[model samples]
Target: MDFTNLLATEVQTFINQNIDSDINRLLLKRSSFPNVTIQEIVQQIKGRKVAQRKFPFLLNENIIFPPNLNLEQASSQSTAEYKAKDIKGKSFLDLTSGFGIDAFFLSQNFEEVTLVEQNPELIKIVEHNWKTLNRKADFINQNLEEFLESLGQAANDDFRKFDVVYLDPARRDQNNKKKFLLEDLSPNLLEIEEQLHSISDKIIVKLSPLIDISYLVSELQNINEIKIIAVRNEVKELVLIIENKPSTVNQQPTTISCINLESDEPEFSFYINEEKTATSEFSESLDFLYIPNNSMLKAGAFNIISKKFGLKKLHPNTHFYTSEHKLDNFPGRILQVEKIDGKDLKKNDQFNIISKNYPLKPDEIKKKYKLKDGGKRYLIFTQSINGKEILRSV
Candidate 1:
């Protein structure tokens, strides 16, 4: 797994030149650097290919990439950069430094940082890459438990007490089976709660989006905030911020921030209590329909969204909103409507079709009606307050 020699000047140049080269064909050709195998070159090429878009800054920047699985698991440059802004510290620690993506970004904010990883090879890789970028970080070749046990022996004893101890626990078990339970995740965050608090007053955790936020709030004592981070309306990660002090269920509700990184969408922030307390006034069909972005829907602020924008819910459980007046700064797509004949959905074959609480899904409707997706026109199938199923297009 030693790739230090593969990073020679001539080898890197070849990789950069053939970044788009067909991998198998390039592999068959003669190797310019006899010391580096064709397979190693392919790894470099494949890595850079992904980094070019997912991690634009790291591409062609002498950064060593891990295997395919590691690259897949590593945080995207966008998410890493976004989370970096939330962290504040003179010093911080990454409990499980996979490919050092998060650590690399966190280094920009923290004066001192510690990266703890069990894999010695990955430790060496990131250590070299960090040096090339003129960034200095203490890399510890140890597992999470070992690092926590030896926190007293941290690189700089003066900065032992970190401003934040960040961790994205391995959600897979020894068998590589995905586990959603917090107890199943290792370094088992719940098990190390006390030790983590002893080292740092604040901790930032990244969890699978599938993990229940309510379950997390019940299990962890000090949940200061729960952030749902999404890119392009696609939910990616659920970040939980916890403090050292004990907290109760009756304490102030967790602030759920539904953040959509898409430039065109709005970022919505609200409390769970707000959504629970508000009651929506149902309406029959209206002039416009508003659909929330995935992040906002994931945050479950259905009623709160309607209340905030002076919109009325279509039905109690439909999660569709309508208004006679268009709202500015809406968090989701707002479409002007004209009711369409359900039978002629086939006639309008090339329009964006959406369905909520309808008998047929968008795909089913498209397949049955011989419709093609996308265009200026918008078609929505939903149920109105009067129990009438409405199919509207604009």
Candidate 2:
């Protein structure tokens, strides 16, 4: 049977059976295969065949697509789950809705949603997927610039206004270089803030986790909240919240929230600048050491953390601080100091080692300490405590 003559079902079956043969790699390697046309191949595999065959395996079983979508750009289930929570019940306009994952999920919460996509093919796929899910949304096939311009005109006429304007800019070039820094973004927001600010009262911008949170906050003066979202304990996205204007209470403290989506409990909540927490200070030394939560670290709340946790900053730039005692309510890792070894872990054996905010990685520390991976071990290696100290539980 000729390969091209096969029915869609048969073609999918054939592809599935030979997936182990590296068909994706093979398809890319052949010069005669149309690079631009492979989108159809992907849509067929994902939309119809995968939907039918792997329906049980998917998290969002309601949404389906054609074989054309570049699965490489498909948002992960975790990101979808988080977006569902953040964008719910708010009138949100997605400025650059690639594949419509964020828009689709956010639509669940809001009375109305507008998804703008510049790519015609992606817009079509998103429409199909939305229809499959039986969800309704306004899909605009216009560039972000044009959409923003229209919104600006409407805003002047008291027509277009959104509670939230969502942006997840494409953080890659045609060559796929990682673009996480604010200055590196395309059609750069730095250049378009005036127009963007006019259309929306609040903006929620999603950024790559690789970005430095400090740099982003510094660049976007309107930002009021910074969320470091982790799914199943693995950090995924950094959400920056920017408002139209300052709040009525000028002294209202900024919040740095850490969300552990996979947790069974209420997800380890804490207030960074709570009045009581602001004046507190760490005791000089104690039995256990408490590490402040990741959001606090990302926020660079060094003074607040030092006071709240009663810990001392080990070094100026090193985020890790030292506390002799542990707070029962602290949200981060707690370690019991066994022994302090400086530049002599090489001579020690049977020690389980872990490193954080330090020059060396976990594996490198393991090799140096001559220890094996995994256990309820108490080995800690950090550069902040006066240049590479080892502390293990007694």
Best by TM-score: 1
| Tens digit of per-residue lDDT, candidate 1, span 1-394 | 5666787888888888998888989988878777988887898789888888788778646778777877887888988888888577798889898888888886688888899999888888888878878889899999788777777667875656888888999988878899999999987888999888888889989899888877987898778889899888889899988887655435577889888884577778887678889888998778888888888888888899878888999898788888888887888778878666667656547877788888889898888878888987777878877874645555
* TM-score of structure candidate 2: 0.73
Model 1, residue 337: C-alpha shift (Å): 1.3
How high a TM-score does candidate 1 get?
A: 0.93
Q: Best-fitting candidate, measured by lDDT?
A: 1
Candidate 2: give its CA RMSD in angstroms: 5.8
Error of 2 at 44 (Å): 5.9
Query: Considering summed lDDT, which 10 consecutive residues are worst modelled in model 2?
Result: 53-62
lDDT of 2: 0.62
lDDT of 2 at 31: 31
Q: Estimate each model's TM-score.
A: 0.93, 0.73
Cα lDDT of all candidates, in order?
0.82, 0.62
